[model samples]
Target: MTTEPQRLQYLEAMGLTAWTARYRMPNARPTEACEWELPVPDDGARQAPGERLHALLDAPAEPSVPAPAAPAAEPRERPPAGERKARALLGGLVPEAASEEAAPGAAPEPARSVESDEPREALRFALQVACLDGRWLVVQPGQAAPSPLAQRLLANLLRAAGVTPEHPPAFEAFHWPQIEGLDVQAPLDEARQGLGAFLAGRARRGWAPERLLVFGDEATLARVLAIDDGRSTALDLPAWQGPALETLAGSAEAKRDLWPRLLDWRREWHGEAKGEAKGDA
Candidate 1:
């Protein structure tokens, strides 16, 4: 049987207010707090023995307040005598400055310069191209267009190779310069993987050429080969079996050196020359 407080808690939980319907005897004093027993269900519709026991066990338990926890122990202080002795020993072991007087004929060691810890500047350059058919892809340092001088130089190179700006070549040019937002200073392996994928996609779309004329600095070539030796030379790409000519990127001098080489390559591609196309610079 529950107490008066428990009964009142249950009634409150059930959303009902409990009150006593008191009947006062004439001249009788008020009684102390009273508890009324709740009516039990009839045994005719009785619950199973196990179920009754489970209900009794599952009833809400009385809440218990926890006792206060013990305070933590304070850390021990260090002994001042030991600390002072350590300080004294360290003071006694002080390294004296080297003697100004050098041993006879003994050469002094050269002072080593301290290297800067600052990161080196990122390599920056644009790979630009001008096709025989007046199509231009002029990538600037920051992914912008090539200057007019650069475009004119490319045009002159194309003319040297017997390609007129009015007429497009039979084969589609491999457009490497049009790659947008390319980080030139990205890790070699990562850049090569991305470039390989790009090349493969272009090849799938019938953009594979017999020969690719890559005009870029040593760094660009290194990016293509995924190496850092600064050697720029012809190598076969995964997408194309033909040679990819790596030439110097900027300036009129570089273009002048490249035109004759491009002319020879164009001749070989057209079957005009008897020997193999010498695409390597």
Candidate 2:
């Protein structure tokens, strides 16, 4: 059998805002890297101001400031309640994307949940860092439109990437608006840059994906590894002819030893009425 990595625990970050990245090792506990920085935005509503300062900066003194309009899409939704818990050392594998939407306020639905019969007996825990392209997709089940991040990191990523709306549900962020089409949520456009940096930092901390895909933009690839010194670099992943949008990582076989056990006290959080809920999914 192959030996696991000696060290784990990594974070993907950039300037002001960043997310955490966790790594698992065979026969050992999983760990993660510290957080990083990405810039903050001035205002959530001020995102995607289509005029450059150069034009307005040189324009007549009496410029017309247009009124802000409601977002050009459906309203936001409420997030489902409850997060999963886990314990245990792992066998050095990752998990697949379990994309089932939980009803609003329902019992916890797992992206992946681990429970075992022993203490600290779970094999691993999971982190759901959702993103809508460069934007951080903040969506729930019962909501309307999403709120934009009032942060610079997100804005720069959008501005730097030349973000645009492809379809109502599709917004793109990139350097060349014509070429780099990143479909993201409108509210998240502001924080795109920072999120990219966050994903990059996560990669350094052993959160790298064995299989990577790029949908919307290269940030999908960044989900696996950070954007390095090279732009025209090779994507690190297995050979799959499927769609490029879903960059997958890890294997179920490597996660054999995850200890799956709920806390003695928290088990009752669901209560016995969850018998039917437990049987589903």
Candidate 3:
């Protein structure tokens, strides 16, 4: 639980101002008033723009000079909406580019939506892969490190699955666009290829798992499933897709709903009459 002073500090850090009641309420504990601690500058310090503006406003005003009037200019027609938008996009840096199609009697260009104009972002994915007791767990990446409470929940889940300390899960991270800032034309294909290669490499090293525990939504799980081709020819693991780890961590009802599915998978893959332990290589 956060104390009042700590809460005030947090608010100040976020650039928020806090207001306090002038009078104390009946049956309430007496509390110190929250106040802004604005720094006071020395007399020799430079004046702020506001102070200078106030000084200038208080000073005598100078007489302004009248300029000669010029002849009125002819009114021009407004350009089409597309041309106006193009000009705004270019910031008037290239004047000729904006007016290239401004020829007399030319048809207006069709308006394009901003969404259509912008390039679509590449599909990106991050997954937490863990190998435990002859099973591969591919979970949606959560916080870099889980909180103590979240860790406890994960431990409980593992224990329920008959995992032991002697067979701690081996973890790895998989991310698309592996090299930061690298432009990937087809991220979906690349991600599938990369993931497939990783799985195949692990299999060749004789670390193949019997079952795959996938934790993601349908859309996310689909991408992982689509890698069944040349790249992962060595793998033939049975899979069980379920809700993401973060979802299970936040919802007790979701955890309860997951047990039946987990038990079914354990029976099918591990052939465990009960959720019994299996030796993992």
Candidate 4:
């Protein structure tokens, strides 16, 4: 059995106003709120629950009273010092700097510069040096070996000058960024030094050539020889710079240009040799 207050609460939840009797019957038990009373019609006619609900719905609603204003709450106290520090440490792990809203009209922080300690990329270059028929020929084939067409053209050019080198000519291939290991910082300087030493060692051994023929970039040859100009006799030897064999093989104009230079160089160097041979004869 539900109590009187619970029964009243159920009726109130159903949108119906509950009423209490003003006077209690002789055999009725006392209610929890004995002093409180509500005047209700005591007509002898008892109505069903549905009829009572309908009558209550038909009745006019009472005027509503405004609730009293609540007092303002006090400001909350700060958390303990240790708790605040722990929260700060946790927040520091994963920084929210990027997520933070930027201030209006404020200058942004400058970007940080990253410094690298690794060695710079190795300098890349390719060349071939050969000693042919008592003459040094510094060639920049731009690869391991010259193309067959370039090689054939070179042989024809040499033959035109009436010079014959030994079969299987001695070739020295020099390439930069060798070994792909340590101690290769100054590659350009190292290349110049290594080539210079090779030439110096050959000269010391009494195999110094009387002439120098370069079939590549003159500027590059000059740098390797530590000379101001490739055409000048700064190395104490007759020198001539000509187009690369690759260029001569493909272009008729290049071959035509090279023929005259080849003839002039051969006459100057070979003529001296011939005159010396005549005197010796």
Candidate 5:
């Protein structure tokens, strides 16, 4: 259990403000401390952003996990709908790249209805990477194109990393099967299995990145790293063979807070790469 002060501190660090329920007993003085309790979902594995953050704050901190031996590729079928919910939550938080289509006066596609049975939940998340050699990989979220804001942010990050915008980089991306809606939660067992399978497939294809720059709430990190502990700027996971850094997801305010830190990290990474080259020489 988390104390009020500690809970408030965690919320503050995550850039969130907590408030009491709209309805309250008459003549009763509302206490902010008492309202700190977050509503938990029925499924223990699938948690709302607030509950996930609390879990992270409450868990004992552990050292980064060591990188494990490379696993051989194996045939595995993708998990079913409910199984993908936990990962979907993280996917929904991260925006992917948008392809620039020059179709002359093509009508805009309609947004998918949340109530529709179509598995659009899987389409809402994406992973993108921009390399220095003018190459980029944009794992597109569902059927939707990346938002303009997401595109700009990715371009900016790549430019800051020394990639020229004009030349751009090789770009590749894929969409996952649509699940239910983003709001649905999956059971813990199913969520873990889905995440494991997804990561395993990516690893087998040599798609593991040295570091993942995650942009979203604390829950996004929890889902990606499969850990429920205190939040940190950096997390090392042997499963991905790298460390991941957390940042504000897609918001103007996040841009202000994240860019400086991202640039600094890029500089350090470049310096380390150069040092390794010099040592080898």
Candidate 6:
């Protein structure tokens, strides 16, 4: 009984993908949903019940910030630890790399895979999720929307602390010329590359923003993040951390308050998503 517009509305409303076991209508009875198992954008078919519900949302509706700039020259490659931690530590958080087939018989492609090798749960990052200009806003400085509050606090703190902020975002992927005493695995530039790749997903099927913020409710944030990818709804940054008080860019309060909230969001959603995934399983 649902139409494409209605389906898209749900997607827009939720701001992410829905692969859980429950039907979108909550009231609607469950069906096999074989048709929806196809890829998005031109995979036209009068498919499963979920399609009618999932299609209501739009794609490319949000704007992603540019990642942090790379250093003038590639940072000297640090030695990869010959002996690292357990590989599956991230398994408990992300569960599986997003690379698993979305549906039973779908083709293997980059869009269908979401990956995290690090043990994300133990890391810390301040997730800031925001939307503006009819497009979703990312916190990537230079590329991300400028937040006066964030920039002023982080920049001042970082410069004084000798910590250089990465433009693309993420500490693991890039190199910080000025920052000292941070032992994150990747540098800012490198981390941003991974985050950038995630956003390229069909929709907002990317990482959990450490600092998830929206003008409206959680639903608003979800919609903007997933606008480009039909399958993504919300974001989660399991591994986000900040510099020490003497070595950070933002105020001690902002860093403490903002980052913890981001982690709290993950903790809450992690519980919920785990439940949902289990239900689907």
Q: Arrange candidates by lDDT, descending.
A: 4, 3, 1, 5, 6, 2
Report the C-alpha lDDT of model 6 over 78-144, residue by residue, as the tens digit. Answer: 2222122122222332234233325768767555444344422212223333322212233332223
Which 10-residue span in candidate 4 carries the lowest summed lDDT? 74-83
Please identify model 6 stretches exceeding 4 Å from their true place.
1-144, 147-149, 157-163, 166-198, 201-218, 223-281
- TM for candidate 5 is 0.32
> Candidate 5, 57: how far from true, in Å?
56
Task: Summarize candidate 2's per-residue lDDT along 158-246 as a digit string, tens digits.
Answer: 34333332312322232211112323233122234333444565444344433222222333333323334422223332311211111
Better of 1 and 6 by lDDT: 1
Instruction: Give TM per candidate.
Output: 0.33, 0.15, 0.43, 0.45, 0.32, 0.19
Full-model lDDT for every candidate: 0.42, 0.30, 0.54, 0.56, 0.42, 0.36
**Model 6 backbone overlap count:** 66
The parts of candidate 5 lying over 4 Å away from their true place are 1-145, 163-186, 218-221, 224-253, 271-281
How much does each candidate deviate from the true structure in C-alpha RMSD? Answer: 28.8, 31.9, 17.9, 38.4, 30.8, 28.2
Q: After superposition, how far is residue 121 of candidate 6 from its true place, in Å?
A: 35
- Residue 28 shift from truth in candidate 6, angstroms: 58
Per-residue alpha-carbon lDDT of model 4 for 7-113, expressed as tens digits? 44334333346666789999887776656333445785467655675565455446455457855454253322343434444454433333135567778878876
- Write model 1 residue lDDT over 148-256, tens digit each, in one string: 5545555555666654545433322222323334333333433344434444444433444343444433455445543223222222421111112222333446555
Task: Name the candidate that leads on TM-score.
Answer: 4
lDDT of 2 at 129: 34
Candidate that would win on lDDT: 4
Q: Please give, for residues 1-281, the per-residue lDDT of candidate 5 as tens digits.
A: 44464344334433356797889789998776644545666775667786775565455546555558855454243322332434444455332222233356878677887655432222133343333232222232222344555556566766765445355433333222223333323333233333334444444344444443333333433444453232222224322111222222334565565555654455444555755644643
Give the runs in model 3 whose Cα sits over 4 Å from its true position.
1-122, 142-148, 163-165, 180-186, 204-206, 218-222, 226-236, 272-281
